[model samples]
Target: MKFGVVVFPGSNCDQDMHDALQNDLNKEVQMLWHKDKDLSNFTTDDCIVLPGGFSYGDYLRCGAIARFSPMMQSVIEFANKGGKVLGVCNGFQILCESHLLPGVLMMNAHRQFVCKNAFIKSADGTPLKIPVAHGDGRFQADEKLLDELQVNNQIIYTYCDKNGNITPEANPNGAARNIAGIRNKAGNVFGMMPHPERATSSLLGNVDGVEVFKFLGLN
Candidate 1:
């Protein structure tokens, strides 16, 4: 399926995601502007990606302002209709703000911006080394919601070490349960802090992110 990468006012990773999908994965991709509300060209078989960046200069909150964009309205409608939506970093924040995903992305435990490579593992113990860059990347949710997520198998990825051990020390931003990524109840929408697109290219010395895309049925 083709992929569409949304570009917001301050988006910096839009091209990165496009390159990963178009060049590395050999998939068709389109750059969608935040002001454009039409998604008629894309179908349920396609995917819409919200790349990492400081949307609207992170004003009001990380993604608070960007959620009301005309394009986001269409995105929300698309997601509700079972369209595949993937949000990374700030994009993840937007999904939460839009209520497309549960929980909120809070500031880091140390209240500082973090940018580095972190290890994360899937439910089956598949590990990947992906990069995370954000200030408010910590994910928090209510106990009830957390339990529901775990029960539904919606918690797709969690922080871990190189050897695939889950520990507090391995948690980068103090996300609750070390949650690095999660999917909606229907599994059509996904939100994650770690940047799998950044790790997809072999030239970067790590292709573990390819496994992530494969798991998402992108390959």
Candidate 2:
């Protein structure tokens, strides 16, 4: 499937996402501008990606401003129509702000920007070492929403240790239930805090990030 990476003002990781999807995964890719509202070139089978970055300089909250972008309007419609969308880091914040994904990305528990490798595991206990970089990456939701997410199997990934054990020490941002990533109930939209694109290259000494794409059915 084709991949379209949106470029919002101040977006720093758009190229990283493009390279990972095009060069590393050998997929067709297009750089979609935030102002462009057209998405006719793509289909429901294609995936739209919101890469990590400090959109709008992270003003008015991490992704608060970006949700109103022209491109995001089209993205929202696309996702509502069963189109696949993936958001990473700041992009994940946008998804939450747009109501595409549940929960909010709050400030890190330590109140410090975290930029380091973090371990996260899938529901089946499969572990992947991915890099996370953000000050407001902690995920929080009310008890009712948490139970709904659990019942719907919407929680996709949680913080874990190298041995694939979920633990408090492995939680980098103190996300609720150690959640590092999750999907919408429809399973077409995904949001995650880690920068999987950063680990997709062999030069990075880790290719575990590619697994994230695979999970999205992109590879």
The lDDT leader among the candidates is 2
For model 1 the local lDDT of residue 65 reads: 93
* Stretches of model 2 off by over 4 angstroms after superposition: none
Off by over 4 Å in 1: none
lDDT minimum window of 10 residues, candidate 1: 210-219
lDDT of 1 at 125: 70
lDDT per residue for candidate 1 within 1-112, as digits (tens), equals 9899999999999999999999899999999999999999999999999999999999998899999999999999999999999999999999999999999999999899
TM-score of 1: 0.98
User: What overall lDDT, based on C-alpha atoms, would model 2 receive against the true structure?
Assistant: 0.95
**C-alpha lDDT (0 to 100) for residue 202 of candidate 1:** 86
The sequence of per-residue lDDT tens digits that candidate 2 reaches over residues 19-91 is 9999999999999999999999899999999999999999999999999999999999999999999999999
Measured with C-alpha atoms, the lDDT of residue 84 in candidate 1 is 97
Please give the distance, in angstroms, between residue 195's alpha carbon in candidate 1 and its true position after superposition.
Answer: 0.4
